[model samples]
Target: MTKLILICCLITALVIRINGHRSSIFAAAPAPSAPAAGDIVADTCKRAAAGDPDLDYNFCKSLLQSAPGSHKADLRGLAVISINLAKNNAQRVLGHIRNLIGEETNNTYRKECLKTCKEVYADAVGELKDSAKSIDSGRIHDARTALSASFDAAGTCEDSFSDGNIPSPLAADDDYYQNIGRIALSLAALLDN
Candidate 1:
């Protein structure tokens, strides 16, 4: 009888210890404290840059902090800002693509690649617009989907040139836009978490 009681007590103690450790392991997230002005951008950019290999921490911080109300923006606002940054970059690249196409009247193949790049940037701009609207409407999944579609433009544009064994006229632009896309996507991911 004493042995039985000892065994039960041991089992109870083990179960209690396991449950206590488990609860500690699964503790709720810490509360968000109010940070000083600009900390939100700094903090979110740091986290986003840490998570994304292509995202430059300095670039991310500068881009986010430059927004009109960045010091006051929450994660969702940062998402919006990042999307806007990418969209603006796409638009600028479109103009650069047009200029390159105009300058390359003889290289039909390079011109073709430029045209494809232009199409992709145009599509990306529209997709980014939809992404912003989706975000505004609280459709996070759709926003991410459209944002991803937009993000593909940079790589797709670069790949078109690579397939033809030609140098990409927009190589630098592609790299720039790719980093912007990574930043935007990373910030959006934070909103989900």
Candidate 2:
């Protein structure tokens, strides 16, 4: 009976030790504190308006990294940031088109179409930036107007691309242009508070 008790005690001790080690391995690390929703929104908007694509992308990426689960607000933030980046990049591309038009020799309808696309892209970027500024300035109606302009430009670009003879990088992907339009619409809706 003494030997049986000793064996049972040894087994219990071993089991306890194993459990402790397992727990140490599987223990959840402390979660970083979430950023305030307002701060996230403000920083994102500020970066977008300031024409810092990298900063804008990082701000959105941080929001997504902090909340990888089913956070609708975070997802919306991600979508908005992405749209802002795209708009900004597209504007930069427009600048390049203007430069090309001045310097390049192959100025044709295709080149003109490309330039027009860039103009539309710049308009969208400006609208989004204005919307962000309006939000920062607490001008809700102005923000809505800016967002409407952004959507209109995006739609015009989509329709132009759909004509199917525009020799631009934008014409390569029908889905991508459609997606940009959708993002513009989504951002406008999300920002409409």
Candidate 3:
């Protein structure tokens, strides 16, 4: 009878141990799941557009969706794409500004505005390089700061024309740069959440 009780006790202890372990398994924290691959871009763009009135939802979605490899991107990938787009646009605008400066031999006011814009855009290009680095290094705050600076650079360029009472030839380019910058900033915000 004593042996029978010992065996029962052993079984009971074993069962208790198994139960404890099972409870712990249930209590443990869950691994974070990524958003569905297909929805990331549109979902991110939707939230971004909702957050910033200056950002258009369709434009953000379309731009990200159309970029190479964006369809399979996570939030970070989308951010990189947005930053790259901004950099490309800014560089193009810078080149266009240089060409304008060269072409305007007589219009000193426009040329002067173009020169200021060139300086601003050049600074923006550098800022964007820093932003890209920040994002790649997992420094979201620094990335946002640099992205915001790059976006502000677009406004500075526009203001260059406005302050001088000269129409901006790069208005469209500035708009594109700012919008993409906003998207990049929004995506960086998502990485922190």
Candidate number achieving the greatest TM-score relative to the actual structure: 1
Sum up the clashes in candidate 1: 0
Rank the models by TM-score, top first: 1, 3, 2
Cα shift from native, residue 154, model 1 (Å): 0.8
Give all TM-scores, in the order shown: 0.80, 0.46, 0.78
Winner on lDDT between 2 and 3 is 3
lDDT of 2 at 66: 52
Candidate 2 per-residue lDDT over residues 84-189, each given as its tens digit? 6546555655565577566646646656665666677677778878776665565656766776666565456556645655444444332343344344444444
Record all residue pairs in model 1 with backbone atoms less than 3 Å apart, i.e. clashing. none
Clash total of candidate 3 = 0
Worst 10 residues of 3 by lDDT: 21-30
Candidate 3 local lDDT, 1-193, one digit each (tens): 9999999778766776877653433445766686665587788898887777888888898888888999787788888888988898899989998999999989888888888889988999999889888988999899898888878878888898899887899989888887788888888887777
What candidate 3 gets wrong by more than 4 Å, as runs, is: 1-38
Query: Which prediction has the highest lDDT against the true structure?
Result: 1
Give each model's whole-structure lDDT.
Answer: 0.88, 0.54, 0.84
The local distance difference test score of model 3 is 0.84
Collision pairs in model 3: none
Clash number for candidate 2: 0
Residue 176's lDDT within candidate 3 is: 80
User: Model 1, 11: alpha-carbon shift in Å?
Assistant: 63
lDDT of 1 by residue, 1-193 (tens): 9999999778766876877743433346755677778888889989998888778999998988888888887888889988998899999999999998889878898899999999999999999999988887888888899999998898999999999999998899999998888888898788777
